[model samples]
Target: MRLTRRDAIAVLAGLGVVGGGAVAVDQFDPPTAETAETGETGDGGGDGALSATVTATMTAAAAVVYPSQTEGVADFVETYVVGRARDESRRDAMRDAALELDAIARDWYGDDFADLSADDRDSLLRELGVAAADPVADGTVSERIRFHVVNELLYAFYASPTGGRLVGIENPIGHAGGTESYQRATMLEDDAGRVERAERAGDAEDVEGSEADE
Candidate 1:
C-alpha cells in the first residue's frame, strides 16, 4: 500500500500525537512569529513551542526522512509536531534542535535549515553524523539532533500503522482494527461451540443405545 501523509496523520491521531488530524489539517493556520510571541494561538502548547521556524524545519526534515511516495508531507509533519510539542520539555528540546539545525545550515550553506535544498539538507544531516550517534536529550549537538529530530520523526513514523506495514506489521500496537480484528477469533469460537454440541449429542446417543441393550 502506498503510504500517504493522511494515513500517517491518522495513525498519529490514533496514537494521540494530535487531537484530531482532520481538524488540524483543515483549521491549521501557520503561526507567525508575532502571533507566537503574543501567545494568542497554537494548539501545540501554551508555551508557544510550535513556532513557525520549528514547523518549517520539521516539515522539511520529513520530506527527507519519509519514503518518497508519501504525500502531504508538510501537513502531516505539522500536525504530528504540534501534538508532540504539547509537552513543555519535549517542546523545548525540539526548539533547540531546530535552532541548532539552522545554525549549522547558515554556517555550511548560508541558509536556514528549512530553506536548504533537499540534497543539501540530507547532506547536512549526514555530515552531522546522526546515523552513528547515540540519541541523547542532553548530549552533544549531533546527539541532540539525533534524539530530538531525526530519531523522533523516525520513531513516530515506524510506530504508526503506515510505516509499520512496511515492516510487515499490519496492526501496530497502537492501532487496533476493532471488530475487524476480532473476526477470526469470533469464527473460531463459533466453530468450537458447534464441536462441543456435536460431542454432547453423540454422548447422549451412546447412552440411549447402551440402556436399550441392557
Candidate 2:
C-alpha cells in the first residue's frame, strides 16, 4: 500500500502515540548516558525533530527490512521516526544506534550508512548479526540497533494497514474494522463443513460396529 504522511501519523496513533504525538511502544529501555551523549551533542536541536543523520539511517534501515514492493517508504519511515523520537529516551537510543551504524559504514565502506547501496545496507546489518541477536536497550551495538531501529520500524509498518495487507491481514490491531469483520460468512461455512464431516465419520463408525456385531 502507498502510505501518505497522514497515514504514517495514523500508524503512530495505532501504536498509542498520544499527548500530541510523543510516541509509544510496547518495549524499550530508558535513556542511558551513552545515548544521551550521542544525541545531546549532535545536530538534532531543540526543535523536537529527529536529526537528519538519524532520519537518513532509519529510512535506509527500513528499506532493507520492509518488502521490496513497499511504496512511499521514505515518507512513512521519516514520519514514524520523527514522531517516535518525541520521547527523549527513545530519541537518544535511536540517535545512538544511528551513529553506530554510520560508524560501521564509514569503517567498512568509507561511506555513511544512508549513502550505501541497498545491498550494502542489508549486508552490513547481517554482518552486525542483528538478525540473530535479541534486542536489548543497553546491549551490544547489534542488539541496540535491533531494538531501537530495525524492530521498532518493523512493528510500525506491520501494525499499519498497508503493511498488514502484505501479510494477508486486512485489518491490523489498531485500524478498527469492528466486530462485523470477525463475523465472516466463510467462518460459519467452515464450521458447518466440520460438523458435516464429523456426522459422516460418526455414521461410518456406527455402521462398522453394527457389521462387527452381526
Candidate 1 lDDT at 181 equals 39
**Candidate 2 colliding pairs:** none
lDDT of 2 by residue, 95-196 (tens): 789878888999998999999999999999999999998999889999999998889888888776566656765455764443534666433322243223
lDDT of 1 by residue, 47-141 (tens): 33336667788888878987877666675566566556545577778877877887889899999889899999999998999778899999999
Clashing pairs in 1: none
- The regions of model 2 sitting more than 4 angstroms off are 19-50, 174-180, 185-214
lDDT of each: 0.61, 0.65
TM-score of 1: 0.65
- Cα error, residue 16 of model 2, in Å, equals 2.4
